[model samples]
Target: MKHHCNRHWTASVLICAALAACGGSAEEERAFVASGGPDTPGASPAVAGAPVYRALSTAPLAEVSLAPSDVDFPNPERGFYRFATDPARITATSLDYVVADGQRLVYTPADLSAYRTRDLPSSYLTKLNTGFAHLRKQGLKAVVRFAYNYPSSEADYLNAQDATLSRVKRHIAQLQPVLQANADVIALVQGGFIGAWGEWHTSSNKLTSPANKIAVRDALLQAVPASRQIHLRYPRDLATWYPVPPTVAQLLAPSPTAAARIGQHNDCFLASPDDVGTYWSASPAESAALRTYAQQASAVTGTGGETCAPPVAAQARMACEDILREGAAYHMTYLNRDYYAGFFAQWQAGGCMAEVSRKLGYRMQLQAVAHSAVAAPGGLLAWRVSLSNEGWARPMNARGLALYLARSDNTTVALPLPGTDLRQLGPRESLQWSGEVPLPATLPPGSYRVFLGAPDASQALSTMPAYALRFANADTAITGVQWDAQSGRLALGTTLQVP
Candidate 1:
């Protein structure tokens, strides 16, 4: 897929400025509604002097670069962490380790091996709900998977052990309600429930066939919420299921289709030329085509996985340079930090672990901002902001952006940027947003602090600071604009005055 690294937005600033220059008359002023409430028109008398426009810009610090962060901070649905856990084992105490380690995502593999031949029990479903509740309370998200068995021995791998197609379908139907209820905490669901360890291999019932795979795919697409995505084990599987890869336009469509929602996961990443059959192709041309498709598909839907031990000859490919190159190519969002211990040790010894940690997912930073310093009650508050994404991928989930005005009395007004989806902000991209926000005529006259925020798209978690996206600016001392953990906002180090 083509990488979109540069985008620009120009708001109707000229129109608003023209009206503001006309004595800021109420009749000429636009009717504006604050996010918190509707607008109330109030009359404003004409000013006697020229209109004053104030602007503020960031200053550089000697010690650090302002565009990308080196220190680690918890952001949703990204970064490295442990995978594979039983639902009932997740508890507040168990999560202490995750928090202390500076992680915000976990993988939950719900074991249904016992119920492969029958329906899922209500008690087990409740455990699933309870596990997600724990994650929500701890300010974390889960990469979910449902599997019948985890085969460890060579014999287990050789045997066909998963349930028949009918039983798998029945189980998905039973678990749909639980999945829907906790969609807020689920980052994405792995396309599991077939083969050993749910990696879609070694299925005794031949579930790997194209027909059976499509059936399972259809069921999963219907089971999960439209806002979430499902990840399959290999790129070839997607190529088989969807003979024609989706266009960049279709993948990024406002309402994505099932094909767009399916993503890729590489369990044995970088272990071999084809990652140990994760990209099975009969010819070099076919392999290139599958990889190109994965790159395009994952650029929008998202992709992730874990590393495996390479052979003696392939050890060089596990080096820092190789990993970094492939990571960016795949647009990887997360990985298994604890697995394949030797490779991680190599990363630490090679002085690339820190870089890997910071660049795994989206690293958004505020480059600069310009805005009007003073305006009448109903006049427009014009603003222009420059932002950059320094990481390897865009945010896989939905996010909403807004500009906020707050007074000393704790009164806050929000002006949400309509139709601004951060998912479109590709890796290594820079964007400029310029817009005019209409102020309510009845807004009280005062000096209000300005802030910018990227909060969750869901109303239930929008106000929670835990789910808010924090910028990569170092601190208030280095960059005048600082991250406010308490309010989940970036204090822009400027204010707007109203008379």
Candidate 2:
């Protein structure tokens, strides 16, 4: 009871437009592959041929910040510059990049550092703000982290000095304007500014003390708006304050507080027993408690980090399977591509790289879509959409889902779906959504192709496809209408008849 169409590669939007205009008498549907290939490598066969579903192909998806980020210090040894001062390297394989802030802040006196804590000079602020604009121009978002110093040796780590509480607070206060101005391009901000390299360890200051940590955390909370989350270096850091996870009742009510806004990042992820100082526990019982707290807390908040040098038995202990399993358990949202190259190479050789990359963050795939075969203009169209999240993490931001009606004449109308909040969709979770869409009376009478779009809630980015959510579905083309490349909306692979 299924028909497959041959896949062809053409950049023309007219082809999609033509597909959108096709209307037939048969009350049937055909599923076609957009990428002309099997699902993303390692996808289980169970979901195959499950209606017009999208399969993540062998391509790097955007918007999800992975490894080898865009921002780094000017390393003479590595032949790298501090920031992207020249043209961005636009490669087919690259996605979003990580911008680790404060790398220019040396581990010396204020005059020795390129940036001073007393005040973020106007020139420095302008340069910092330009990075976001550059990313926007390049069709990318930044995974941001800030640190005042990078320790080169154990002696430096032991002797490192951190900025005063007043100075740290002042720096944050100064950066508020830039943060607010470029919030759109910033994916998430890591809680930095403590210890060496901002990992919140080996600090000359007492930032690690429970009371001081709370004060600093509160400052970060107030500095960044509630819309974005501030991730901490350790799970115990957050558990010290927001120890208990949000109850189901509280989550159902959807009450979000600043305390709940804190998330986790394991810098030495999967590198050792207890992940190299990430979790400091003496007994198995205590370790279980910390892990439980982190898993529960991360269910609602974001978690992401990178793996350090694994032990000699890394292949046996830190295999791809273990990494994926742990990533799922921790709800990890991002990873550092620049580090742990050898481990990544091992995964590639072991035939697990594609699966790991495809499911890195939020991998949402359409399972089945049920809808009316025919509907009059300005009439009711009931739809039931089933989606599966096969990724390691859920969407941590507020996103809007809507039905896109692409007419034969290249005109499009977007209708928002009520009660479709993507934040509730978690990894390995199946979402069954049903809604009645009242077609706009102003809609023209013609055959239309129905499409699903997860657009940004921000007006500035709602129309930009780079910021839109790309579903795991395969057939994204609409043959009957010119495709909006800027939005990357997915066609439902079926047409609606209107007489």
Candidate 3:
């Protein structure tokens, strides 16, 4: 039970005496008592000459269900990386892939018989389609990457017999049907099928050249749908083709170009001075330009990869501070959770695991909300919602934002909130939007609590409240505050009285 002391009650009584002597309206004093009045011991004491505005608690909530990617509420577009298609890979708490996971698949293109014909075996097709179909069923998305070989591969997988440009084109062409069909579950595709480990380096075909890189990238772009983006290995790879990347404003603009669709994937993050050739230039000036490109591109497009080497003996490894700094600067949306267990182990040991987990993707919180206390059934219900982003990246996916009015009978009416685009909510920024939704003329006349909901626009998971975007705020319980913990909807606490 909530506990309050008599000390605040005594202080409020003294303040009421002073307010009465100063000609305070009896109606105003009565209003305060009606609104969880100070007569309830332990209520906040009013200031000597302050307006008696009714205020509710705005304190930060505990790190319980509100945390990002938690089992109950899975937010999209950001979170820890996962390597395999195994559903068992999720954490005991089901925190992994709350945003999305990285799916890196390798193939030996040398065996033309395997992919030479349009008549690919149903088994091979099943392998490709099954993972993505499962992701769709689970209500998840993934960053997909396909490679020809690895850093260490069996001799049978050598590039001497690998697919040539023509064969690679045909391979991508064959994969087009599956790729387009699964675009709903695919976050983006990385330009792979090149150098060792598909990092676009050390290829037997010398695919590192700018011309070859462009050709491969163009082929992949054609293979994947325009709705999806393709990530490059290095900054110069993007700069070489586009010459000029999109500005922050341009990235947010409608109808971005294919050039603007390109993103970055730094595999050797924090491994060396040049990140183990992820940045090949020796000149510091050139390195600075790459950094500038990465930060800018990542703001709009996705930027993510894995750590290659953990620091040795007190070196600047991927610590909690570095995670926050780089995540914000580069707007990293995802990371490989498998390879560098040691790096993350250190983060866990340092006691910042919770912070990293909470901020890995987008952590949207309600800063303040203002709305009318009463309205007619057919009247306008106006609201001003102030939200703050505490995560490293913005939500790039499309989601539906709507107002939920729930009656005492446990029924809810969903009113579409027009002109609300959540993708514009940038990292670590406070965004405020005000809108008036027209209440249905047929809405039952009763006391209905107001709530905000962001659901998958596809309507595939509309009934799944756990799949909704959970906000980082304290008032989540429906009975007291009308918050549906199963869904990420917020109950504004103020009731809308309909006459």
Which candidate's lDDT is highest? Answer: 1
Superposed Cα RMSD, model 3: 11.3
- Model 1: per-residue Cα lDDT over 1-499, one tens digit each: 0011233322343334344444345654542222111121111222356232221111111111244467777788888966637765687666767867878888888888888788888888887788788888887888888898877753677664889999999888888898888888888899999898899988889998889988999999889887888999988888776777665466557778778788887888887888877777789899989889888777776688888766554433678897788889888898888777877987888889888888888888778765556655755565566688888888877785787889999999887765457776789888866555667767898998878889888787787888888888766664466788888988777777777
In the range 382-471, model 3's lDDT, one tens digit per residue, is: 455567777777775656467788898888888766555666677878766654455676778888877778776556666566457777
Off by over 4 Å in 3: 1-74, 86-123, 151-162, 310-316, 408-410, 476-479
Q: TM-score ranking from best to worst?
A: 1, 2, 3
Task: Estimate every model's Cα lDDT from 0 to 1.
Answer: 0.74, 0.58, 0.61
| Cα TM-score per model | 0.85, 0.73, 0.73
**What digit string (tens of lDDT, one per residue) describes model 2 on residues 224-289?**
756677888887777767767753233334546765677887777777778877877888788878
Segments of candidate 1 deviating more than 4 angstroms: 1-68, 153-155, 311-316, 376-379, 440-442
- A best-first ranking of the candidates according to their lDDT comes to 1, 3, 2
